[model samples]
Target: MVPPTTGPTHHLGKSEIEYYAMLAKTEVQHYSGTNIELGTACGKYFRVCTLSITDPGDSDIIRSLESA
Candidate 1:
C-alpha cells in the first residue's frame, strides 16, 4: 500500500482527519445491529475504546467526529 502524505493544511487535510476518531468503550455499549460485526467476543480490547474510521478520500468535507 502507498504511504500517507504530510503537506500543507488544505492539500493534505484528509490525513489529519484520520488521526482523530470516536471512542466506543466496552463499558458502555456497541452493536453493529442484529448482526454485531465484532461480536460479543471482544476481550479486554472490549474494555478499551474503539476508533471509528472514515474514508480518507473524502476531502470535500470538514473533519468532525464522523469524518474523523
Candidate 2:
C-alpha cells in the first residue's frame, strides 16, 4: 500500500507487523484518516516507536558502542 510520504520504501514483514502490534497495542491502519489518527495517537501516548530502518541493520553500531 502507498502512504503519503513516499521517499522511502518500508518493508514490513509478518514478524514486523506482529512486533509493531505489540508495541503500538494496535494494528497498522491503511486509510489516510485512520492512519493519521493512529499516528497522532502514537505521538500523544507513546514515548517512542521502535521500528527499524536501514538494511544490513545497525548491529555494528551497537557493537562499536560497547567496545568503546
Predicted candidate 2 versus true structure: per-residue lDDT over 1-68, tens digit per residue:
11122112245554565565668665332322343453564355522223332342644633432364
The TM-score values for the models, in the order shown, are 0.16, 0.22
Query: CA shift at 32, candidate 1, in angstroms?
Result: 23
Per-candidate Cα lDDT values, in order, are: 0.29, 0.38
Q: After superposition, which runs of candidate 2 have C-alpha atoms over 4 Å from their true positions?
A: 1-12, 27-68
Choose the strongest candidate by lDDT: 2
Model 1 per-residue lDDT tens digits across residues 1-68: 11222232243443444343223221212222222223232223232123232343764322332343
Q: How far off is residue 53 in model 1, in Å?
A: 12
**Residue 50 lDDT in model 2?**
32
